[model samples]
Target: MWDNIGSPFDYIAEKYDEDFSNSLAGTLQRNRVWHFLKEEIKAQKPLHVLEINCGTGVDAIWMTEHNCEVWATDVSANMITIAKSKLRDNSAVNCHFSICSFNQLEKRFEGRKFDLIFSNFAGLNCVDENEIRKLNTAFFKLLNENGRLTMVLLGKNCLTERFYFALKNEFKNANRRYSVALAKLTKDVLQPTWYYHSLKLTKLFSSFVLIRKRPIGLFIPPSYLNLWLNKHPVITKLATWLEYTIGSLPIFADNGDHIYLSMSKKITAK
Candidate 1:
């Protein structure tokens, strides 16, 4: 899916951080993901991490600050350029940025292995279902024994999004992610994207065993609804609290705007 998209991200690279990463909803949503990531990295200590679709290198720089050796990659050269600029003043010798697509992982880093293979915020959604399943083998070859693969993917079902769109009587738009959809990236650009349920993603990486999984934006609402959320700070706080209360419940875990999944590569007896 991403192969044919031809760098649609290039158009948004300059404003991505300002429009989404630094926005209120993005900050709140990312804090949830970082909470889990920090805990996992702290437990591992001195981890070697490979981050895919590392747009703007926000997480990569943070990992370097925590003493992890990080190789951050993105498919878009423009995104990679922006990421490099962000790290230029940091003096983080531990972090490296490169332009490499998900499909190029095997060819680009054939013998490299990492303690953690991480991709955040729907980056993997750019690929088709078959390509995502193929990642099981690619990741298996690149991960050390018992290493972890942690991904944050857009979920197939988001109750809040459905309700929001349904309120506008746009049922088709509400259900757009039920399978594959052509997501509008900009006014004139559309990219093929896929939303996966937790079970479906797990099945794709059958060689790995699930260790942790949770919902993000379960009550927080998707970023597109951020304008309303920003205006209603009290409601946003309540939603955050509600997410804290029920986000991990099995019934709610895969129904959020995005799902967080962490799986460990199974040890195979030689």
Candidate 2:
């Protein structure tokens, strides 16, 4: 069912960073993710990390620079190619790249276990709940005792998305994330994407304990508003401040354009 996942993402590999990863809005949201990442890495330095759907190896590079060993995987070969190219100059970096998807993690890693498993952006949104159930199983098997899983996924309800689309009178677009929809990867490629709420994920990963949940882009606008945000630096700064101040509140944490969540594997009784 997900055979075309790689093909769609491959089309965006070359310019994905330029378009989203480095954009003003993207930087703001990603910085929040990085903040939480630092907390995770600080707790356990020299971590063994498995990163799934590691587009362009941005996060992997960051982790390796901080003394972590990273095994980064992406389904798109082109994306992996770009990721590998970025690390070619840094031979000392302890990072590896591979072509793999979330569902295929079990077979690929087999007996391997990691101290942390990370997925960024909405990469995990491509699969449905059934696939997520499989991922939960794979995560449980692949992680060491007390290991953490960190993910940043698009949420089912986004205040910014709702307001942005409503101003344009795009009623359907405002609520598009509420159901399964095809997200435009590029002009010609649309891939199936699912928006998951924090509550839903808590139940899905029932075997694990939810340790952290933060709202990304709760006040910062989505990437689509990059042009407008660029023009208004002051508003952008204010939004950033607001997000930093109140994004962690329970009322707002699960309703952003994206959610950053971390869960720890439960130590089961024999």
Candidate 3:
């Protein structure tokens, strides 16, 4: 979906943060995702981070503030420009953003070794399983001993959500995007493939220690918050309260839009 769209994220880059920095759903989703991620960062030594498809630099800024050295990259030049602008006024002097995709990693960062590797929002889905599987070999050489890799991946539920969203919005142009995504999900076949399964994701990366999996979302909702924010203030308030109240409850965490995975590199031949 990413390569086909060539950074549709660029279409919303400037206002991405503004879209949901304070909404109940946004706050709850990010809070859960980052909170779980921070635990791993805190457990390990101060490390360098390599974030693939770093969207608009929001996460990059957060990482820098938490004292991690950040090298953020995306395939979109426009997204990189936005990231560079966000870094302009920040104190994460250790941060840098660039335009590089997974296929181009060797050409751009030939000898770089990172203490951690990160990507957010199902960026790994942008590539195929075979290619993504190949990264273990590439990253193994690039990671310091016992480094960690963490990311927030979009879940299969997003497809159904998108379907209902398009149906609710009733937009004529909605199906165009939906069809494209569905096609990608099927890979031109009859079946669909989502990027991660909490258990299977842990298994796929089992060459490394399976640190933990925390499902995000499971309760709140997706980006449609703009549809309900002002019309029903009291209802919104109640919803917001419910979100925060249940954000950390294991039963409710993964119901949102994304999930967090924190895995550490292992030293052994398994």
Best by lDDT: 2
State how far residue 34 of model 1 sits from its true place (Å): 0.5
lDDT values for all models = 0.87, 0.89, 0.65
| Candidate 3, backbone clash total | 7
List pairs with backbone clashes in candidate 1.
none
* Residue 60 error, candidate 2, Å: 0.4
Q: Which stretches of candidate 1 lie over 4 Å from their true place?
A: 1-6, 88-91
lDDT of 2: 0.89
What residue pairs clash in candidate 2, if any at all? none
* lDDT (10s digit) by residue, model 3, range 207-239: 567666655755456656556555767866665
lDDT, candidate 3, equals 0.65
* lDDT for position 47 in model 3: 71
lDDT of 2 by residue, 155-247 (tens): 999998899999999999999998999988877899999989999998888778999898889999889899999999999989999988888
Error of 3 at 182 (Å): 4.1
- Pairs that clash in candidate 3: 215-254, 217-255, 217-256, 218-254, 218-255, 218-256, 219-255
Off by over 4 Å in 3: 1-6, 20-24, 43-45, 89-92, 158-193, 229-255
Residue 47 CA displacement from its true place in model 1, Å = 0.7
- In model 2, where is the ten-residue run with the lowest total lDDT? 1-10
Candidate 2 — which residues are off by over 4 angstroms?
1-6, 88-92
